[model samples]
Target chain A: MGDVVLASLLLPLAGAVAAAVAPARRTVAVVTAAGQTVLAVVLAVTVLRDGPVATAPGGWEPPLGIALRVDGVAAAVGLLAAVVVTAVLAHACASPASTGPATEPAAGRSAYWPLTLLTLAGLQAVLVAADLFTTYVALELLTLGAVALVALGGRGAYGPALRYLCLAVLGSFAFLVAVALVYARTGTLTLDLAAAALPPGPALTTALGLATVGLLVKSALFPLHAWLPDAHAAAPTAVSPLLSALVVKGSFVVLLRVWTALGGDAALASVLAVLATGAVAWGGVLALRAAALKRVVAYSTVAQVGYLVLLLPLVTPALAGGDGVAVDVARTAWQGVLLVLLAHGLAKAAMFLAAGTLVGVAGSGRVADLGGTAARAPVVVTAYALAGVCLAGLPPSLGFVGKWALLDAALTGGRWWVVAVLLGGGLLTAAATARVLAATLREPGPGDGPPPGTPHGREEAPGATALPTPRAGERWPALALALLAVVTCVGSAWLADLVLVGAPPGVGG
Target chain B: MSTAEVYLVLGGVVTLLGAVRLLTTRDRLAQVIALNVTGTGTVLVLVALAATGGGEPDPVLHALALTGIVITVSVTGLALVLVRRLDREDDGG
Candidate 1:
């Protein structure tokens, strides 16, 4: 189990190296994606059965060397990551649009897979690293890979990519400052030891505040989220899934780590909840108003992030009075948090890929322009609808179960306002998703579909094809993903038990 | 409060100024430079933080600082390339 745990960290790096050296791109892509997915599943099971897995690579102990630990939360996230990555990679490989100019850089045919694998490696490292310094470095690597990926966009990509790079680097510097403060206070970078050494004082509080703010910027929360929509909306079709679903969530994983280590200070969680509420309303409004299909999905990501943030306040409601958190409420809330992370990751990745497919077939990305997708791309439309079910927290979806757990937790604590916030976020998401669904399923006039007679839509790029409907290659991958999403929701009860396997003892047990 | 804190304060001031500049400035070059300045401040703060112990500084801290500098430099290089790309986009189509 420990070896598998270690292998999960090394596998992505190994895959990157393998992809670089291999002559064939398709084989390397499949081998790496499949291998990583298997390893992630093994780790998830290991975390469930064994509680927590810890290993110090090269046998160097503690502050000097690095310790990599996988708790239930990390492993559960790893599982979500594995599923999403493999599915997205499969979609990218199968989808005709993915082979276009934008994804193919000047580097080589093999370059895309390596960069993606390397980014996955960095993200995995960030999740498993037991030291702050290592997490920061890993995060930097993640951003570097992501920046390169984002810049591969068409003509307008450069500006958004540059902005992302600047903000991400600045965010890293803030995180570094916080790490230094922790080190100064504890003389060690190991998270557990440093957390133990944290006292209620100016230095610790300041460090936490700086770190939180920095992560907020990186995670694209609320006012600081200016860079996200343009960058995400403008990226190549295949790349948006990686950007929106995984890369943006990386910082929040670190924030979760920092938040946990800080012992979930109630006052701070309260402030975070306020920001989250605003994000829910703000992101929802923007999504509802956005004209572009991809932009709507991007803005919805911001809104979903708000629900994830709400976990902070929901779990630690008693923190405000210094009475300590109620363990039962905290536990249920923790369950809610884990469920939200899992459901959102899967559903959002599916949404991006489905939206990408819609853009590919429709010849336009505008919400108002997405005419006749149901007839033209039925499989993809179905995928989009299933993903929407998850996003909107509809019944039997993991998303619904997650929110149900959260609302239940809130009700237990009698925090009715939070219950309202969660309900509002769901409604807003449903309304926005309805807009896309309606636009997509709307009847295509004589003007819609690839201009009259072009075969393969060659003459009309991004235009409606006269073939009526795209066949299996593009359609199957999305259907598979959507089916998995529906299956996850239906199986959510058992899955919830699995995720709660090694959560903190007092949380959602 | 202490000699090391003096260094910490100075680094914080530098980082704050640079962060404000990075956020406020629309000029690509200025933002890149601001990022570097803020990065430099973080490095200083890390070094100063190590000094506060009144003993030999941790070697890991030095290595970590070097890593930060390397990453910052690479990012700065990448950002500049992107900015140049944007300019070309303007020049042509």
Candidate 2:
């Protein structure tokens, strides 16, 4: 498992470099997809069985050489992420990718291949990183790779790309500052050691605050999420899933590691939970009102993130206290959070990919103009609806099971407010789903007639690169990803059991 | 103040000014320049924090700071590229 983790971390990078220099693009895609998926799958299987796997390059201990650690949580995510990357790459290869934004369509196919794999490599590194500096380096690498992907969408891409870059840099800088501060004060760069030595001091508090703020910005939580929609909305079809699903998850995984490593901070957890609740409500409302379908899905990404962060408060009582019941509840809530994370990643990736298909068919992103997609692309509509089922926490879906576990935890822990927020969030998400479905289902509005050739053209918002017609090769990947979302629903029981084993060591131990 | 303290103070001031400039300015090039200044200050702060009463810098900390420097350079390079593209687009070239 240790060796597998190492391979998973290194292979994408090696593949990226090879892809860049290689004359043949298809070979790179095939080899990378096979190698990355195999390694991640093998590692995930081992992790579920063996608990956790770790490796230190050259056998040097932490505070010295870097160590790569992958726990069950990372392995689960890596497994899903590996599949998503493979599917997207396959889609990219079938359609010429690096039509390098609108400006440099001549930039050649190699342009997209390298960055795509590089993003995966960066994500893998962040997942396995055991030390703060290692995570910092990997995070920056991931940020760069993601921004490149966005910019690759061409001409109009620069505006959103620049905003994304600035915000991303700012967030990563905050994270870096927190990292340096932690190392300086504690003289340790490893999570467990630093958290252990961290005294009750202003410096520790400041570092925690800075790290959270940075991650929140990176995660695109509500108000700090201004850069997300346009940047995500504007990216090329294949790029959206990677951005919405995994790039954002990179920082979020970091946040989880930092908070849990510190055991917990109730005050910060409470404040963040409040913000999470706000995101759930605010993002849902915005999604319902969004003019473009892609932007709606983007806002939903922000909304789904709300569910992810609620784990902080849901489990904080146990992590921050000595109460046995709280610990019991924390265990359940932790499992629920991991499930939600997995479900959202799959659902969002599927939704984005499917929505990209519809946008292509309609030739415009306008929700109202998206009419007739149900009749045109039922497979795509099915995919979107299935993913939406997860988002809305409908019964028998992974989202429902996750929300159920969370609700149970909140109820048992007597965190009634969390319960209210959870129920309210589910309803709001349902509303957003209803809005998209109704718009897509109903006849075109009175003001606008049926669109003609390339229904997506003419209405193109300034700076929005026209959504290309659906590529025949990309449909399978889109449908496969969405089906996987459905499979996760059926397999929720199995997944919950597997994930619960990975919950952090008993709080207050 | 001691030499180290003076360096720390200077670094702090530069970093603060750079952050303010980065936030307040709308010009892409100006933001990139501001980020570079902030980046340098960040390196300075890392170096300053590495010092102990032992009167010597930890080589390991210096290595980490050096890594920071390299990463910052790449980020700045990317930003400059984007800025250049923005300029070209604005010029309608």
Candidate 3:
């Protein structure tokens, strides 16, 4: 089982190398993606059956060698990421060669595959990393691959990609500085060692602040989120799913782990809670007003992450004298937040992929120009609707399950304000989604002729791009991912069961 | 203060200064330079920490230093590409 865990990390990396060497385009995409999916499944099963597994590289002990540990959370995230990567690869395999002249040589495609693979490996590494220094390294690797993938879209993508690269590097440096401080103060890089060395001292506090700020920037939580809208909106559609779905969550997972390992300081927890509320309100408002389809989804991400931040306060066990109701609320809230993260990954990936198809077919992403598109692209529209259901926390979706849990938690914890904010955020998200649907469903204006057929268009023209409409074949991947997002609601029972098994005693609803 | 402590603070100051410049500067080229300086300062700080023998010079830190160098170069290349593209677009317009 341990070997399987190790192999899961190595398989994508190996496939990436092979993809680079393979001559055929189909071979590169299928081989690497399929291999990763299989590895993801194997690792998920191992984690479910065996529980969290830790392995130290090169026979070194804690605080000296790097350690990888896959707990319930890491396994779930790994499996989810695998499903997303496979779906993306399937889409890439079936879609036509992107319309632009090949800015990258044949070899560059091979290089691209390897970079993505390395990124997946890095994400898995970060999830399982037991030491702060190892986590920092994994984060840097993830950023490098993501930045390259952003730039892979050719000249038009250069500006946004450059900005992403700069901001990401800035975030990485801040994180590294924090890691250095922690090590200097504690004389050990491992989380266990640092926790043993902790008492909320100045150095540790500074380290925590720097690390939190860096991760927030990377996660693109509101205010620090200026780079995300452009990066997600501008990147190639195929690349957008991975960027929005998997990469951002990677940092959040680390933040959660760090918070857990740090033994849950009250002041720090409250600070995170405050920031989360702000993120929910600010991101929701911005998402509601965005005009571009992709930008709307991107802004929604900023809001969605707020729910995860709220989990920090909930994860700490309540004192014995505290209300028993509060304890149950905290556990329920934690589970809700985790489910939200999982469901959001699936739904966001589907939304981005579907939006890409719509953009590909209609040649514009502006809500105003997407008129009559829902009629033309029923399947795509349905996919969007399903994804929106999850995003809005509507019934029979995993998203609803998450929101219910959170609302219950907030109410029990006497945090009525958080509950109110969650409800308001949900309503705002629904309104934003409705705005897009309304524009797409409406009849074309009298002055408006049939929308342009091409995918690429004049800079000034709203919907004049010349790319081909999505055929039946191109729609399956989006549909499949969307279905998974919905089916996640059913799977929640099983996930909840697993989470309960691992959860501390007396910590549940 | 120990040399290690002095260098660590110095590195932090340098990185903080570079970050401020990067954010405030309008010139694309200058922004890239500021970012690079920030990266350099970060690496220096990490090296300083390792030298202090607080932590055992863990391989992860070494790995991070290598990763930082590679990423900095790659970002520099990408930034230059964007600068060139902007120049081209301006000329064409």
**TM-score-based ranking:** 1, 2, 3
Predictions' DockQ, in order: 0.80, 0.60, 0.50
**Candidate 1 per-residue lDDT over residues A1-509, each given as its tens digit:** 66787888888888888878787765786677788789888887777776778888889986677888887777877777777778877866765355234333566234667777888888888878878888988899889888877776656778998999989888888888888788878878887678778886887788888898888888988878889999888776667878887887789888877876666666788788888999999999999999988899999999988888887776554333323346667777777867887888888888888887787677666787778887878788888898888888888788888899988988887889889888899999999989899988889777655544443212234554254455566666666766676678776766676667655433533
Sort candidate 3 into its docking category.
medium
Task: Judge candidate 3 at residue B48 and give its lDDT.
Answer: 72
DockQ winner, 1 or 3 = 1
Interface RMSD of each: 1.2, 1.4, 2.8
TM-score of predicted chain A against the true chain A, for each candidate: 0.93, 0.93, 0.91
Candidates by DockQ, descending order: 1, 2, 3
Error of 1 at A79 (Å): 1.1
TM-score of each: 0.94, 0.93, 0.90
Which of the predicted structures, 1 or 3, would earn the higher TM-score when compared with the native?
1
lDDT of 2 by residue, A1-509 (tens): 56777788888888889888888866885688788888887877777777778889789877788899887777877877888888887767665531233346566235788888899999999989999999989999999999998988777787888888877877777788788888877888998899889976788888898898888888898778888998998887778889998999889888988987776677898788889888988888888889898899999998888888888877767666648898878888887877888888888888887887687666567887776667666777777888888878777677788888888888888889888887887887777777777766766454443344424322233454443345566567777876777677787776776665455665321
Alpha-carbon deviation at A300 in model 2, angstroms: 0.4
Tens-digit lDDT string for candidate 3 (A225-251): 888888887776777888898999999
| Runs off by more than 4 Å, candidate 3 | A62-64, A97-112, A316-327, A446-453, A457-468, A499-509, B51-71, B74-93
